[model samples]
Target: MLAATEKALEAEMNRLKLAVKTLQGEDKSEEIYIGSYLLARLEELGVTSMFGVPGDFNLGFLDLVEDHPTIDWVGNCNELNASYAADGYARVKQGSVGVLLTTFGVGELSAMNGMAGAFSEMVPMVHIAGVPSLRQQATKPMLHHTLGDGRFDAYIKAAEQFTYSQAILTNTVSAGAEIDRVLSDCVIKGRPVYITLPTDLAYAKISSDRLKIPLPRHPSPNNADVESFVIDEIVKQIAEADGDVVVIADACAIRHDAIDELKDLLYKTGYPVYCAPMGKSAIDETYERYGGIYVGSISRPEIKEKVESAKLILSIGSLKSDFNSGNFTYSIPTTRTIELHSHWTNIKYAEFPNIGMKQLLPKLTARLEGGKAKALQLEVPRFDAHVPQETDDIISQAWFWPRMSKFFEPKDVVIAETGTSSFGILDVPLPKDSVFLSQILWGSIGWTVGSTLGAALAAKDCNLNRTILFVGDGSLQLTVQELSTMLRKGLKPIIFVLNNSGYTIERFLHGKERKYNDIVNWKWTGLLEVLGDLDGTLSKSYTVNNKSELTELLENPKFAAAEVLQLVEVMMPKHDAPRALQVQAELSGKTNQYAL
Candidate 1:
């Protein structure tokens, strides 16, 4: 006991000396709490807002977030919605990572689905879970949030399947390094990462010296010889193609931060550019070289013919999920395709690992600039907003999508739910600088409502234009509670809820008249009044049943530019679906093979 007491006293003396050195500015590493250090890193990454729910384990951390100078704690309706919101925020605010806070066990489990969806869609996010203290964990006592079996790692183990990296911060000594590693992985891999912050460690003082340097966003440089060889091979292929090559951009082209590099290739080479369903808005669709969306068999005949006939297809960041590629119907053989990914490249049958598009695109563009790949003047199908001629006043899917496209202005952020909206809006061309957000690969229904909240907040921070969301009534029921949180935060977004009678997409896929595909019909316009808009001062709701009413509403400047939140209930036939969806559903049905 005497020796232990003496050792404790010596440790105290050492701490005091370090504190004095810090105060005197002699020590370069300033001391800061672990939570503060983490928040500082997030702020450096331009995280203006974080989404989460308040729980006992995370309340102390929330105090730090509440007191933060720039980071706002966006209290959400639930953990799942918060996770979805974070995904949307990251999608809108490029070059920044989305931050999510949740309590251990139940809270983190609730957010698991959203995190998995973000991982599937390649959205960069950091999910910080506040767990029990070190002392508590050491005692192995039965905790409220944990199972009675004392299996504390169960949740994190479950999260391992979804996240790119995981960090369990046990001590202040390693807290900064752990945080940096997880955050760097989150951004570099463009996927969600899990970090467990114990309550005790949240305030533990750690040296902040590492915070002086920013985290590395890009991966390490490729081998000089290998990179040069790869670039030369790509240039040779393009030059030999004699302008028979085409460029197809997909979802990862945007998520991996290769848009600028991709645009350079498209412009300099003058190659006809097409995007997959998931890659909408990755490049400027208004450009003359831009063709329409390519979804394999589901694509329009003209687009399919144009893309399939190319001798060589340069596929950038291609994620050929079933829906994105029309149920794996891509006819382009591996021998005729060159694929560029975030961390590797594949030329025909040969794979060149570690040669990423972000670094290689510039070299390829430079080589192709001076007549290496002769610029061709090929005819691109004009993708303009043209409302179909309909005799009836009732709004149909074909008419609604094109008409809505006309209402979109430059720099608008458009989010679509997975059902009708995602397929419906795919045919329409958005204005330049417009952002398109959708969970195409994941296809999570009702994600748009929570995403709109996050996207709107991000839009506010980035000083972008209006945020518009299109969601089906059936899908909205799952996440409608998030609208209250949006109103509380004073975010103005125009939400168009298609009030069809039932699950239209499911009907098309299977069980066309099944009762399971039906949902409870809510009083569409009374939502705002019940959801904290008692005085009707903060919001407005409208129900448009016909083309004339929607046309007038879309044209009204006050309705379009409302300072308050707006919800438009668009009445449409229950059986109608977008043409793209009809084609996709048939392909998906054949793949499902329920009868077989």
Candidate 2:
């Protein structure tokens, strides 16, 4: 007892000594300002890359960033683009937070869309904005970029709606804690957080001991009682079911670390698991018990028939959204439906039954006697015959995905940019254990590029190899500033830019007659070369207009050594991709049916 007490006392003394050292040596107030301190905190948080477009208000901060070897400042053409890239980097790197710096008002507002998207998708990001100095705050006179009267509170309130949390740093003491709290929340909740730093505060000198970097607290699920009950109910239903049972895995199910557990459940039961479009590739495609897309127009007929015939529908982490349930076509009738989700279980609303997945999964596993069920046979439909000859002229998302699949190794992590490219990459067969991270719920473009950096960082920590990125031309241009980050860090990733010009997905939805579909054709190859810090060893660009050129570039030895390689100008027409074609066919069929 005496020895244990002495050891504990020694550990406490060591911690106190380290704390004192951190206060004395690390927090010394130099002539260097608050911006430097802010940069220091970012560096301490392991944020090596910052993406943004420098403006008059934030230029000082940018200069400070330039001098900091630990932090690399990247420039984008627009603030929104920078945010998107940062979002992508965060998703890829997992624990690494995204830092998006922009000037006040318009710059801050422009990036809000991306931040909101990150919030919805639960991507951890930090949005830092340079606001007008404290002296400029109370002036009733008109100010540039000011929304109603000159008060900044309205804009801050607007930001609050989109992020997990928001704060304005009027003074130094408030700045550190607020920044720490917001960043800590972002890490804990896995969502975007906002901080607005006043221009004047950037140059102010802060006291030494006041610099406190709080460790983040990760809270696990506290309420397990309800979850256990739901799991028991699900297991009872499954055991009683006579017909082949089907488990429809959704995005929420993918969370809560249930994949392996659910896979084990499937292996024992021999029940096929079908994922929704949003939940595509939830399980290994090679898994014999795996069934493909089920609800949308893209679903296989065999999978559809099985779903329709199932006596028991075991839905794990399923949201009964319009996109998932064929617009309510597959509503449960007399069938026993066990709906599992987060928080609550056995939820009944207006006569609909639903249960909590967290409760249901564990209990269900416990109740079941471990044994393999007989394999059930099912037929799958072929949609190739419906595809038209003209579709061949356009690059099929189907063809593109299979080829792209080859680039991903078992350990590689991929971030898919939003729009048609996102849909295209969703079906691609990834190697076992390969992670596909995306802001699917937010559908924010330009997020993948920045998220890729974060993913790459995460991959490095996991001892994983190269991080692969698939981005649309429209999205890539938005966050192209992050190229400097890749070069600065010496992180290599294969970037495939699907360059068909402006918002192709939106264009397809609006129809070809829309003049807004056009965008300024950026020379992506030239841009990467210029933006990259050329030590003559870091970056290279390749332009591939056709399959032959793409093949040649992939085969070249020079491509292997390049730290940042950009495959520019690969045209994929909107009409060719499966999702696009499906939509087109539906619209065309409606028109034809009405004409007849």
Candidate 3:
């Protein structure tokens, strides 16, 4: 009996000693720091760079990111720009989630608008915020970044409205699981997620077992019977129409990582495929059957006619926002439409839940008879820049967009800002494999400048062609400070600042010449030097006031090569706007019941 008691006591002592060692973080064989684990998971997900502004709460966590071997920390000028940059990165780097790091309270709150835009547009993003320690929260001490009213949950509550999933890491045991769950939601749903990493938990030790296991990247598999029924119904619809079907691809098709499947479907079916404005580069434009953009009433005459007259419409991953659909002017009835979504399918009036397109598309493609669509006699309008013959020096909106379109190259990433830039680029066709990004649904004015930085970085990662940005002078002023961040990172992007004096889109909407539409003018070309290119070695700037000067610059081989950061201040009439914008603004004005 005495010997057995002694043995039991020794076993208890050993257990206590091991517990103490874990508490002191000395046992390193099976455990890893939470911060390092998070970074590892991100690296596995193809996050080569993270965008954010550093702060006191996140400083320690930033230290881990700095020590990381692969992931580079890209410090933005502010949190909002950081969020926008992440959005741009996600758009260019399909199948990869953009990671954003920010501090608690003020920092995270500032990034809310950008993340909200991502949620609205279905971009996959992970927003990681470093907050105060758990002990500090328990004591309820008033911190500098907090609201000072001691309502610690207020900020996170605001995030819930915009984020698809959220988590606060208070316990070390469940931190890894929580992270995996939230990030999985972001990827599967293609929306932003919020995570709060308390300062104390940054170094908390957790089991490293989960690191070896891969996170679930794909959505839950659909029910087999339901999926088959959905596909059968779709095929029946197409057969009933005698394959007089037209396919319209939209933003979610790209966001949900269905581009390859979509391409296979389009190629096999040989149907005339068109894209919405947000889905500009969803299909390879070089294909013979690839039609131009279809923006409802604003669509080019030939495209609008071909699409609306179809006996059946296969709308893939469509998000018919106001601007995308020309102010809700889509004339196609639901009975004539078959919609494929990430999580569900709608065949005419019948809705089938739990049937995701990712799983159903491949099966559907296999079942369809190839090249049946070739029998349909249709003439897809030839989409070209079509620069008009001009007699004068001024570069009108109509002249500039088509002229600029000629400068794009295959594999380029083009980012157009809201207002004139977004609407103008719609009429021009990009090169094969090019990527186009715009905030048509969100309509944030100054988004392109910051997004350009992220897109250029992503383009470099993907080994794509040049990154181009178009923004008006008025919109540029809001987020122009991000230019310095771009210069600091040595990113090479072609930035075209449309030097139209004020808010041209706003002027067209409610105030033709009102003071609210006016803004302070700055020397646009001198911005490169002011932003940090002191000796002009890192960047080149130009001001083109006439058609010939701009034409010469566009034709220059060196300029087209994108060897260095370049900015062109293309002067235009302040009152001028794209035809699409004029029509959209008028529609918007009437909808708002505003007197112009």
Q: State the C-alpha lDDT per candidate.
A: 0.88, 0.64, 0.87
Q: Against the true structure, whose lDDT is highest?
A: 1
Q: What tens digits encode model 2's per-residue C-alpha lDDT throughout 162-248?
A: 898887788765555566567767765667888887878887776434344333423233245654555555666666775356777
Off by over 4 Å in 3: 1-29, 371-376
The window of 10 residues in a row where model 1 has the poorest summed lDDT is: 1-10
Clashing pairs in 3: none
lDDT of 3 by residue, 375-475 (tens): 34656777777999988889999999999888899999999999999999999989989999999999888988888988998999999999999999999
The positional error of residue 357 in candidate 3, measured at the CA in angstroms, is 0.9
Off by over 4 Å in 1: 1-29
- Please write out the lDDT profile of model 1 over residues 1-596, one tens digit for every residue: 22222333453454454444344442325788899989999998899999999898988989999999999999899999999999999999998988899998999999999999999999999999999999988887899988899898899899999999999999765677778778878888999999998999898888877676566566655666898998888878876777678899999999998898899888888888899989999988898888889999888888899999988899999999999998899999997899999999999899999888887787788888776235565667776768999999989999999999889998999999998999999889999999999999999898888899999999988888999999999999999999999889998899999999889999999988999998899998999888888899999999999999999999999998868999999999989999999999998888897764
Of candidate 2, the 10-residue stretch with the lowest lDDT total is 379-388
Estimate TM-scores for all models.
0.95, 0.73, 0.94
Compared with the true structure, model 2 gives a TM-score of: 0.73
Per-model tally of clashing residue pairs: 0, 17, 0
